[model samples]
Every structure is written in C-alpha cells, then in structure tokens.
Target: MAERLHDPWLVAVWPGMGTVAMGAGYYLMAKLGMHLWEELPARDLFEVDHVDVKDGLIQTAPLPRSRLFLWKDPNEKHDLIVFIGEAQPPAKSAQICHQLIDLVRPLGVTRVFTFAAMATGLRPGEHGRVFGAAIDRGTLDRFRDLDLTVLEGGQINGLNGVLLGVAAESGMQGGCLLGEMPQLFSQLPYPKASLAVLEFFATLAGIKIDLTELESHAQDVEDKLETFLSRIEQAIHQVEGAGESAIPALDADEEDEKKKPKLSAEDRQHLEQLFTEAKADRARAYFLKQELDRLKVFRDFEDRFLDLFKK
Candidate 1:
C-alpha cells in the first residue's frame, strides 16, 4: 500500500469475539459506499493458503484479502479510511501493525478507531453497553463526552486490540469501541452486539447512518433466538423432571458382560451448567431487545417532534 490516502482518519475492524465488531465495520463500508483504495496483501500476513475442492477438481480459492477502503464524507473536513480483513495475521501481528501505521502515516492519519466485543457477563435483554479505551487524553475525553463507558483494567488480545497501541506509539490518537455480549457468544456471529457497536460509532464519529437493515437483522435473530430458548427451557425442565428415569438401566448380568456406560454425576452436572447458560443467554437476548425497543420509541418521538418545526 502506497501513500494514496491523505489526511484521513482510519478505522480498522478485524474478525473477533462474537464477530460483532467486524460485522459493524463491514456494514459501514457497505452503507457508506466505501471504495477499495489499497491492499495490504493477505499473503504477507496469513501463513496458510485456504483452498477448496469442488466436484472432481481442486480449486484454489483466492487468498483472504486485507484491504484499505476510502469514503470521503462530503460533509466532513477529514476523509475516512477503513481497513477490513477476512483473516488475522497468523504470526508477527505486531509487525503487521507497524506496517499499517507506516502505510497510513503518509495519509495524515492522526487517529485510529477499532471495534471489538466485551464479555462482561451482562444479563441478556439488557442494553448492551458500549465501552471505550483510548491511548491519548484527547480521544479519551471525546469518549467521555459521548457518554461512553470507559473500560477499566483488562488486556484486549488480538490485532483489533493491538492496533490501537501501535498507532499510539506513532503519535496517532487511537481508541476502541467495544460492545457487551455474553461470553458464550464468543464463537457466534452476534448481530445484536454489532448493532450496539455501530450505534455507538455513529455518535462517536458523528456519522449519520440509517440502521434499518441492521435493525431488521437484529430483530430476526432475536425472534429465532426466543423460540430456540423456549425450546431449550422446555427440554431442561423435562431433563430435570425425568431424573434417573431418563437413563436406561443396565442389565444385572452386565457385571460379567460389557455394558454401555450410563450418564454419570458429572454428565448431569454438565447438563445443568448448559441449562443455566441457555437461560442466561435468553435473558441477555431479551434485555437487548428491550433496549432496542426503547431506542426505537425514543427515535420515533424525536423524529415526530423535529417534524413539528419543519417548514
């Protein structure tokens, strides 16, 4: 990547916990119509080349691309540059960070924002809070003024987390916006968390985005999740009620014959844990939905009230 972008504020979003942050970043790219400006060449970062075998032939699919995109917000003085990646660098991610900083420096990138998910064990259906961490006071103050929660002591692992520190080393202002989500959803693609992140980013970056698509997606997820949770709860109840009756008895002759092992106390304990986690996941989802509803109502009233002043 050359010094193609000049004086642009940059945001780097990588796949991470819940896939929330990456989804939000990609959503912004689509909504803002960002154009691919330069390439970082995934070849330099990822060690393994991913390939697919289709039918009888082996197809070497294109390597994962890590690229920079540009979106000139006509309304703003500074331009926006976004770095989107399909895969994180396998090794020496620190070197990758430095390379990114070098690429953006000539572009006059003084600030970098990264998106991430925070597993705070917060209950579901509750409003997923946005947390902020920054390298400089100015950027930290901006977060404070935005009323974003400041993240306390904790290490944010991975490229999405480390990029901020690297940018700060180069005298660039750096910050990360994190959305709260259940720990169990770490491996899940959490649209709700992504939506929360985007909501915060909209306010923090002063970018006006119509979140209708994300909102719809979030609603659909919640709908399906509600049904799933209900079924899980029912199953848990049945399992608990059945007790020992749920397990098939071993023949007494099994003392001398080989027999299948029955569900042990440990197995029951594990099942109980799963049931508990399922309930918690459902609760968190419910609270998040409630939070969205409140926001929707508020936005509706705000729009109508503003319309009253329109000519």
Candidate 2:
C-alpha cells in the first residue's frame, strides 16, 4: 500500500547542464531530512550502453536508479516529494514520465515541478535569473506575480521539460523552473544557478529550508570565476595592446544586498525553546532547522544546529 501524503507536490530532477536541477533536489533532500520513499524500476527504461573494465576484464554495470524522497510538512499545508534520477535515459523519456505520473497520482500529487538550466550570455559574477514555464494559465499568473522571466517561446529540452508536458496531458498542474547560467560555462557546476532556482521554488512552495550552505558555496564559486575571468581579460588586453580591459565591471545594482528577515523577541524565545527540544530529541532538529532558516539565521547557529546530530 502507498503511504498517505497530504496535498503533496512532486518535484522531479535529473542530471542536466550546470547541475542545477540535481543540486537543488539533493539540497532539499538533505536539509529536509527526507527519507527514501521508493525506487522506480529503471531497467526497462535505462539500458547500459557501456561497461567498466578492470585489469582487461569487462564488468557489468547496474542500470541507473530513479528514487523518490518524501518530506511530510510539519505545518500540514503540503508534503513534498523529490524524485532524483541517477541519469536520464537515452530514449523513451515520455514513457518514463508516464510511469512516474502513474506512481505518484495515487499518492495525491496534483502539481509537478522540474528544475532546469537556461544557458545565456551571462557573466560568471552576475546573479542567475530564474525563468518560468507553466502547464496552465493560473500557474503562469503566479510566475508573473513573482516577477520571474516567463519563457515565451523556446524548448526546455530533456526530462525537465518532458515531465511537465506529460503532467499536463494527465491533467496535472505543474511547471518548470529554469535557472540562468553562462553559455560558456554550461558544462560546469553552477551552484549559483541552483541557489537561484531553489530560492524561487521555496517561495512558490511555502517551504522553509536552510539555504546558507548553498549560498556560501555559490559565493565561493562566483569569486573564483570572477578571478578567472579577470586573468583571461588581462591576457586578452595584452594581446590586443589595448589601454583598458574589454570586460565590463558588474553593475552596482547587481551587488545590492537582499533585505534580511527580522525576528521578533517572541520568535527568538521560540527558537531557543525549539533548540532545547531538538537537543533532547534529535528527530526534532529538522523543525528547529526550519525555524532558523525562516529567520535567515541558520548560519549564526550552524555549529550548534549541527551538534544535535552528534552521536
């Protein structure tokens, strides 16, 4: 028998450009402390085309696995189901989506979401803008309200786009969130793009999860990329005998800081109480983590927050 879930929203992800989709999916799974719910049989859909060899001996490899992780909402608003696939099959993507829908529909999933990457001519230091594409008008309106760049006419290409198309055919409400990344670095892991997608998704789903770790990682990548770009620009300038570098600096508006959430005295007290409870019972740590995330102070208490799980 399938486990009963409350108003669950399904978010599916697979390996793609910039690793945006998979990064967000894994982060959600870790922060929410979701457990493995089920494994979708993949042998029919995914066939191994190559094998590894050790000491000139061919070794058989297992087909890629597709898994589902469940996070029951503490607020009873909506449970979350994150589907992570080890690899996208070379063919029959639509059929795999059909199988996925059939599996989740019975568990009361009405809305589906997929994360993807949009390769653009963006600078490495620039913030990645999230693009939105919906299966329905109502969801489109929500995207507009969020000020997301609506994908007017383009192909989303791959399972990230195909799954939403399948969901629409099955009368499901869903959309795809595409994070903008540099076309030149499309093959690189862009955690900034992943962070941008997750920030929007967290708002859309009304779920709170600590994103400080992701944010820090994104910042580190941004700094490294900036340095790399600067060196390349300097080399180009020397080659061209130019008086000034051709690369433009990032706009001041782009560097503006986002306003942090303010916490009340009551909220502070509540946080302390939650921390105490979490210390006694490790299972309560997720709830405390959520509160800390909501207040945007997860970094301040990160060490202590992680201490809850110390055995």
Candidate 3:
C-alpha cells in the first residue's frame, strides 16, 4: 500500500516558457527544506541517450529522473507534495498521470495546483501580474478575491494543464497559477515574474516564504539586461549614421522627435492599472465569442501526442 500523508496538497511544476514557473518551484523546495521522498522511475518515460566520458572511456548513463519532494510541517495545517519533472513523459502520458493520481490517492490528496507562465507582449516595467484558471467556479472566485487575474476563456496546455483534466475524473479540484512574462524575455528565466507567482502561491497555500534572495537575483539580471540594450542601441546609431554628412540643426530636431516621454513611478502604475482593466475587458468579449462557437468543431488526426498539452 502507498504511504499516507496528513491531508497533503499535491503541487506539480514543469518547464514551460521562460522556465520561470519551474525555477520558482525549485527555489521554494530548497528554501523550505523539503526532503526527497519518492521518484518516478524513468526507464520507460524518457529516452536514454546521454553518455558519460571518464578518462577516455565512454559509457552510457541514464538521464536526469523526475522526483517528488515532501515538506511535512506538523504545526501547519497542510503537508506539501511537490513533483519536479526533469523530462516530461515521452509516451502514454495520460496513463502516467493516472498512475500518479493513484499513487497519491492514499495520501489523501484531493487538491492539485500547477505552475506555468503566460507570454504577454508587455515591457519589463509592466511585469508582476499573475493569472489563474481552474475547472470550478469556487477556485476561480478564490483567486479573484486575492486580486489575481482569472482567465475566463483561454485554454492551458502541457502537463500542467492536463492535470486539471485528470482532477475532474475524480471530482477533485485543481488550479494553475501562470505568471505573466514579456514576449521578449520568453527565451530566458524571468525571476521577477516567478516572484509574483510565488507570492500568490504563498497566499493561496497559507505558507510563509522569504523571497529576499530571489528578489536580489532578479534585480541583478534586470540591471545587466538594461546595459546590454543600451550597447545595442548605440551600435545601431553608429551604423545608421555611417557615411552620412550630418547637418547639426537637422540632427538635433530629429533626436528631439525620436525621444518619448518617460512616465514617472505614479504614472507608470496608473498606466499598468489601465492596461489590466483593458485586458480584462477583452477577455470578457473573448469568453462571449467562445460561447457562440460552442457548436463549431474541428478535427486534426495528427499523431503527435505532445501536441495535446500544447493546445
């Protein structure tokens, strides 16, 4: 029989855009001193192509394996079971999810939460908005009350998204908190975005976490990025002005026209507030449009299983 837990909550974190969601989960595990409890055997779930070279001798080795960590705080109201995946299941993922559910059933885990990121084309100054989605209205309302943006109609894809479908099979409730990442930073880990999600997670799970370390790391990255952009802009100007005879007064007027007004702290906050409201309005319209097309259906007979979570 599987081991029993004290009313545990299962939280699954996986890699996605920006790697922000999964990185935040890892940070939490380390900060909270969570212990390794079990592992999902990777013999069939992932490919074994990695090789180890030691002293000119070649040897094949298994790749990184997915694991589950446990944090049991007897003084707290709930225990946490975190599933950190090194690689997503290669085939028969639905079956894998079902097996996971069965394994945790004995632990009295009926609530599941997943972490992910949403790519919005906003700049860095507009970072830190977190969005949520759930299969039930009660969960959605809970997030709304916390002032988190609740996605009304868009679909969530990948392993994080599929867990919700699995949860519905047993009448359990599940929610996903997706931090907003700018499209420009989609290729890198956005710690600021992750910080926002972690803050909301702490609130939702009734846990306390010190985010001082992550905050410092995020600030450092932002400073380096700004310096890099300034260099690139300078290079562009040099190239554009090459082999040109410039008239001084004309150049000054052109520079003045190119400059844009910089918003103050208060003004930036106001602009972000307005942007959030506008986004919500558009989401409402999208929700209504989806309702009208409820009867319209399309089919794709592709054999790509990974595509299921990409929807």
Worst 10 residues of 1 by lDDT: 302-311
**Residue-pair clash count for candidate 2:** 0
Question: What is candidate 3's lDDT per residue for 85-198, written digit by digit as tens?
Answer: 765665657766777777787778888888899889766655568999986778888898999998877888878878778877877776999888878657766777778888
The parts of candidate 2 lying over 4 Å away from their true place are 241-311
What is candidate 1's CA lDDT for residue 225?
50
The local distance difference test score of each candidate is 0.69, 0.82, 0.67
Clashing residue pairs in candidate 2, if any? none
Best by lDDT: 2
TM-score of 1: 0.72
Whole-structure CA lDDT of model 3: 0.67
Backbone clashes counted, model 3: 1
Model 1 regions lying over 4 Å from their true place: 1-7, 49-51, 241-311
Error of 2 at 17 (Å): 0.5
- Clashes in model 3: which pairs? 158-309
Error of 1 at 62 (Å): 3.4
Cα deviation of 208, candidate 1, in Å: 1.0
